[model samples]
Target chain A: MAESKKPDSSRRSERSRRAIYEAALALVGETGYARTTIEGIAARAGVGKQTIYRWWPSKAAVLLEAFLDVAEQAAQGEPLIPDTGDLEADLKLVMRATVDELNSPPYDAPARALAAESVVDPGLAAEFVGRLLEPQLQLYVHRLRSAQDAGHVRAGVDPRIALELLVGPLAHRWLLRTLPLTHAYADEVVEYALYGLAPRP
Target chain B: MAESKKPDSSRRSERSRRAIYEAALALVGETGYARTTIEGIAARAGVGKQTIYRWWPSKAAVLLEAFLDVAEQAAQGEPLIPDTGDLEADLKLVMRATVDELNSPPYDAPARALAAESVVDPGLAAEFVGRLLEPQLQLYVHRLRSAQDAGHVRAGVDPRIALELLVGPLAHRWLLRTLPLTHAYADEVVEYALYGLAPRP
Candidate 1:
């Protein structure tokens, strides 16, 4: 409903793409990954089946692109982890933003559907992680590497694994619904992960 | 196919129940939670529909019970986390066992199905956590509390949240398939979570 008044070919194509993404996300959210189909998305988006098939090879691919589009918009095309020199505050700010995004209605349901589907489907899981999840993870890796260079993080720490120490808890809590993923919880995750759980000198 | 030679009521019931758990796990593993049905489970288990209905209210209930049975048997009824004096070694041992369970075929597929279902289904997720995940988490909580008493952990650390630093990485790696969840990765999770990512004193 929020398309531009301009009728250029580029504008029209963008509108159609956005509409298809919305339809795909809503379908997967309500009906789940198993039932969501390319035909269903095309019908809901008011586009031809050929159009969807032309743009993406399969329903999984379409959904995957849609997910990437949504996630990019969620971060507003900025790097997820900021490099503001002060690591702790930056981590808190970014993590708090993640908490908000994870809670937001537009992104929440479809992401959960995709995540749920990925669990049983190994190939899908690998593709989704490689394309979508790992890139975002690399944002943390970049930030952590910068942190280590700044001496904010230990030189001995592996940025890849170190990032998991941060992302894993939030993902676990968010995906499992075991507890509330509040800003407070996000802050605590950062604090505990950066400091020794043992008695510190 | 493994029913007993004995025709006594209790013995027959026991065999039937095992068959049902096996059937439910297989169906869910292959077909996923959305498509798995009580009728299918009944047919696969060689039991009548009324027999399934007599024992469980819904497919969710049947799957839940089946998952509990499998998880229990996976651990061989051992305590999830050992209460040995060294918290790091104990966590690594438990996490290694977890990696093995997650790799095992019978437990892997069915557990993934149940976990995936739980993500989008609130009631199922709640029951799964309350009955399965959290009870297991509380086992770590007990171990952490013991660690605190032994002066291995900071008294100020919340055992509940503290345990997440250990389990969350493993769960995230397992559920998402972002990385190979090996014993080495498990050991790294234990090390990073315990001593943390910052340069130590």
Candidate 2:
């Protein structure tokens, strides 16, 4: 198994895969999801049409993989919510980083385009949820469950639903553009979510 | 000064306006936002294209007005958050109603279509937010501010941000199909929001 023959073939395959991902991302960003096609991606990537088909069953699959690659690259920092033994600090840090991703250069167009498409198209939406969104959400579920065990979160709280209190507000701000998604806004969301809006007993 | 206007003219105009709104809604639901043209709406509604132009400047304006009319009709019995002076009850009431609307038959298709388009198109999204979303959100802001005055919500809480804590999780659940939005979930969201996620002090 170790002596798999040629290194050049593997190098060439990796390069082709990267090119395809780049092409898929760029095309979807530029032309919107409905207009992006396998042939077009192949042409843009300088790969044959058959090469794309050989890997992905459909355009949705191609774009889903491309988006995953983009997200992995963008998520360069370690897992977003770090447990520094202080739940509040860890939550704020994670929320702020998420705010930065929403507001900044790395994820604006491609994410917006894909999210928009998913809203109208249920089949595509399912694929998106299955491939990308759920995995990221599961990370938060794991973190929140840990916090609950530590007595930082209430014992009865459902970690899955509770995690949304942290993530959803940020997403709502980003998607609706109801207000500026600043670090300040992110801090406010974290504070309000951790310590309830109602007065302390 | 009482001026006498013909009842026939007013009645005819009302009929035409209703027809146009219905046509626009049905068209947008069947065809996605991009393909819904003013001419197509007029054709479907049995009104002249000039009539639609006379009332609204663009297809966006027509759809905006049409969707608002639909929401207004859907919200006819929609209870405003009942402030039995209990902020928690009021917030839970409004959110539970919202979950019903999001799950309802009338709102699902057209609302989803508009939201999908708004994601990719910022200008349209702004209009959708301004004309449709912001005013509805302001109702919550108004209610929350009242609660702050009554000492239910903390005085320093920004009502707009606080409202997101209530709205965001529900929207997230509905949009992502993450979990069933039920009475129990609604109550939990309100409870967790009113009391801190950390054990109560």
TM, every model: 0.95, 0.95
List residue ranges in candidate 1 displaced over 4 A: A1-7, B1-7
lDDT per residue (tens digit) for residues B69-170 in model 1: 988887886787887788888989998998999888888888998999899999999999999999999988989899999898987889888888888888
Fnat per candidate, as a fraction, reads: 0.81, 0.69
Pairs clashing within candidate 1: none
- Cα RMSD (angstroms) for every candidate in the order listed: 3.1, 2.5
lDDT, residue B34, candidate 1: 85
Worst 10 residues of 1 chain A by lDDT: A1-10
DockQ of each: 0.78, 0.72
- Deviation in angstroms for A17 in model 2? 0.9
Per-residue error (Å), model 1, residue A75: 1.6
- Tens-digit per-residue lDDT, B1-201, candidate 2: 132464877778888999999999888888889999999999999999999999998999998999999878877865566667898888888888888888885677778788878877889989999999999898889998888998988878999998898888887777666668888888888888777688776
Alpha-carbon lDDT, every model: 0.90, 0.85
Stretches off by above 4 angstroms in model 2 are A1-6, B1-6, B77-79
